[model samples]
Target chain A: MKLSEILSLLEGTLVSEHADWDLEIGKVAAADLMSDVLAFADPESVLVTGLVNPQVVITADMADIVGIIFVRGKVPPPETVAVAREERIPLIITSYTMFEACGRLYQAGLKAVDLES
Target chain B: MSKVSQVTRLQELVYELEIAEVMTRDFLSVTPQMTMREFKEFLQEHRFSGAPVMEDGELVGIISIEDLIEALAAGELGCLVEAKMTRDPVVLKANDLVVRSVDYFGRFGYGRFPVVDDQGAIVGVLTKGDITRGLLRKLEVEYHQEEIRRARVNHIFDDVSSDHTSISLRYDVEARNFERGGRASRSIKRALKRFGLPRQIVRRAAIATYEAEMNVVIHADDPGGVITAEIQPDQIVIEAIDMGPGIPDIDLAMQRGFSTAPDWIREMGFGAGMGLKNIDRCADRMELLSPHGTRTTLRIVIYMDER
Candidate 1:
């Protein structure tokens, strides 16, 4: 799924100024634990989480996770937002909870990290 | 003894010591008039492999035991030092870092270097052993200073903590404020990067922090949440606390694809229920507390050098 489509589906606000909204997200990993994200998330996956700390951006950068979507109407602090912008990782904030965010993306044909080919 | 301390000590040594402090000042020298046979006897008597060749207090060349052996093999023992010594040898300035001299040693595969001053006069001779001994002395002084600091800090704190140095950061997550999400995690990431933590550990810490922060923003009621991250030489610890609507069924919440968020929330692309599970997966150790909607607390720890 393109970042723009995911943004529209979740009614997300783009928190990172430099994110390529047109970037393709081939898979999705929805988690709040960064360790799981590091161990399991594939490069180019969109990280769907309700976790709003700066580590999310750092983890995405390390694991090569392409984007981040903060769910359940959560807003990350300015510092976290700045990290995403600096890292050039697309960040979106949605009103959906973790479950709904993952489900919506999954239903839209964004495969889970494990299920993706 | 710890890896953190070892790296810190190495950094201190590399940044602190200069070549002049380590070079030997009273080094033997050979002049061009000295015969190869006489220089060979001098090297054997002193158990030295090399010495600088000087003429009128200026470095003219360098003579090694190998040069004598080569001269002897070629029936040139009667030749003067000028015939055997290497002229215009590689040299180091006294003000240069000891680390730079070490680099020259590695690059040139030389046993010794002539230390020179601004006037092109040879001031001393530096061998690899000299540099190592100097660094050891510097390390001892650093350790002594560290011990005094630790003693003072312990007296003030009353409780002796682990030896590792640490830094702490706090970030606030506001509820239902989409515009400002991820600010805390972003800053935490920057701090970790500044600390030069391994890329893997930084990433795990960051992911766990984001998840914890999000939980407060999404599930907590009214007052929002706070995340405190403590970065240590060996590990990173993050704690997220929030005013509650705590999870009623912890077991169910830990499962994949289970959530209690409203349909609108799902429409916004969340509520697939992987928050706690993800945090659990990322943290080397995790503690979660929720006693029926009062407060929810989550702690995540990641070791910095697991590999």
Candidate 2:
């Protein structure tokens, strides 16, 4: 699914300054732990996380996540937003809970990108 | 920045910067119902050469000083802006790359393009000057970051006079500093990246060093310790030494799922007993020495030629 479609499907608000609307995000990984993200998530997958911190952005950058969605209407602090903006990784906020958001994306044909091989 | 790299940097920035970052925001717009005389006065007051014409919060047309000049020449200053403004003006998307506007200006010969959001609401305006200023500003920021990085890591790669060149970097890691736990490894990773090492080597070294750093922070008994990376031409050897309550059985500690971390540590999403194994996987060779209660030294080596 395209990022723009996912945004609307989950009733998401793109809090970041810019996003690549046409960028295809075929996989999603939901994790609050930065270590799990680094260890298991594949590159180019969109991360659905409830944690809001600068470390989350750092982990996303290291793991090569294409974007981040903050579940449960969680708004990140300015420092976290600054890092994401500097790295050019899009950040979206959704009202749906983590489980609901994951289910919606999975139902929309996005595959899980965990359990690193 | 060097001249050659500066040129390449400029090329990179043009594609990286979006139109929203460069466009002029909170601009004044004129209503199409306003008379040409009123429009001329508004333009003079704001000193704007052109402005988007709006109706009910929507962009309807564009009127410029040239239109005012024609109105004056034709003795039609009393006419409404709708009669003389250009309808269906060309626009640029706020999320589009600035490079696209460069092409747009060259092809359309317009002095400025009104930038809009996905809903087609006029958000800002972009001119040639905006793009130039934006690129220069971004270039300056990038240059400063590059300079700082060079200054920090410059000593590691230069000033070697031995027949066998191996430069070592040491960073202190503080125990229980959860916020700063990854500092040492991050620095090592950045220094290796600046050295222009292969991507896989840099990644392996970074990951292994990070796991080691975390171990010190989580389990070390003393206040702090030191982690060092000795970089040789063929391999990089990383050693993380900590004054800690040493692991009693190295064999059991090496197990993938065995962890001695307390509940608080596990709550922080670490201490799955994977650190040692992760380091082992990334390093070409690994060594661990933990004398019952004295200290723990974890050494990891990665070769340049190895997979």
Candidate 3:
């Protein structure tokens, strides 16, 4: 699925200035814990989480996660947004809960990331 | 250290060296009460073309060689130095960057400027010669360091026909420093890419190193740990060693979802007990050594050919 399509389905607003709306995001890993995200996320996958700290951006950069979907109406602080902008990682914020956001994306043909893949 | 060309180094020095560092301290000053003849004698004795005029330890004016020449031409050698000196001369702060002085010199076309302290007292004088000399001295020191770094980098790339040719990289990880947690891993990844390694292999190595680094950042005691990567033609071996209150039960720590991390760490998205598992998944062979009071070392080996 294109990132734009996922954003609309999840009702998310891209907050970062540097973003690629047409990026292909076929895989996703949803976790509030960064360790889990780093462990299970496939490269180029979009991450869905409620954590709104700068570390989220750092973890996304390290895992090569292309974009982030912050759930539960959690907006990241300016420093976190700055990091996302510097890393050129798109940040999407949504009012939906983590479960709802993941479900919406999954229903929209995005596959869940697995360890074996 | 990264590679820096001479031009870039010079530019960096201009912004880095402060006016205080490049200015001439213990400078000679002429009191305003002295006559121009006395000032001429003082300048000739000290071999100075310019001097700052001070009264009660405060800068009042600047008298340069041109001012002196004008006084001589007008036959005003007996006039007081205050009568001939240029009053309320432009000055610079001691803490300002050398680049500011460069800008001032270009704009003012002055031979020198008096440097002042926070109290507006003259502390030193900065000249074009002083800036040039200071930059050259700093550049010399950095040039030697750069040469040593280039030598080390070249050693890594030399003699492929040798029986064993490998390069090792090491980085220190500080405990509880979540801000710099992944820096070591990122640098390792960059170095591997500089070697032109395969993308998949580099990704695996970077992921494995990053997991080990997170372990040290989230768990290790004060003074933290060390992450080292040794790369040969066939494989890469990464070692993460941490001085610690050692793990009491290695078996349980290795289990998935078994994390001793505090709530704060978990809230920050770490301490999921999946660090070791992630490293294990990325490596062809792995070893965990936690000797009772001393330290814990996680050794991970990944072959170059593996996908």
Better-scoring candidate (DockQ), 1 or 2: 2
Q: Count of backbone clashes for each model?
A: 46, 0, 1
Give the worst 10-residue stretch by lDDT in candidate 2 chain B. Answer: B152-161
At residue B297, give the lDDT of candidate 1: 84
Candidate 3 — which pairs collide? A34-B269
* lDDT tens per residue, model 1, A8-112: 988889877877878888888887755467558877888988778776676677676888888988888887887778788877889988888888888899888
Comparing to the true complex, what docking class would candidate 1 get? Answer: incorrect
Residue B269 deviation, candidate 1, in Å? Answer: 2.5
Ranking by DockQ: 3, 2, 1
**Residue by residue across B11-128, what tens digits does model 2's lDDT show?**
9888899999999997889998999999989988988889999999999999888899999999999999999999999999999998899999999988888999999999999988
Candidates 1 and 2 compared: the better one by lDDT is: 2
Q: lDDT by residue for model 2 over A1-117, one digit each (tens)?
A: 899999998999998886999999988889876667766677789999998776677667666688999999999888778878977899999999999999999899999986744
Query: Going through the candidates in order, what is chain B's TM-score?
Result: 0.49, 0.61, 0.63
- lDDT score, residue B10, model 3? 86
State the C-alpha lDDT per candidate.
Answer: 0.79, 0.86, 0.88
Per-residue alpha-carbon lDDT of model 3 for B1-307, expressed as tens digits? 3456777878999999999998999899999999999999998999988999999888889998888899999999999999999999999999999999999999999999999998888899999999999999998888797677666554555745677878889999999898788888878987887676787788788888988998998889999999999998789999999989678888998999998998888878888788888889889999998887468999999998866
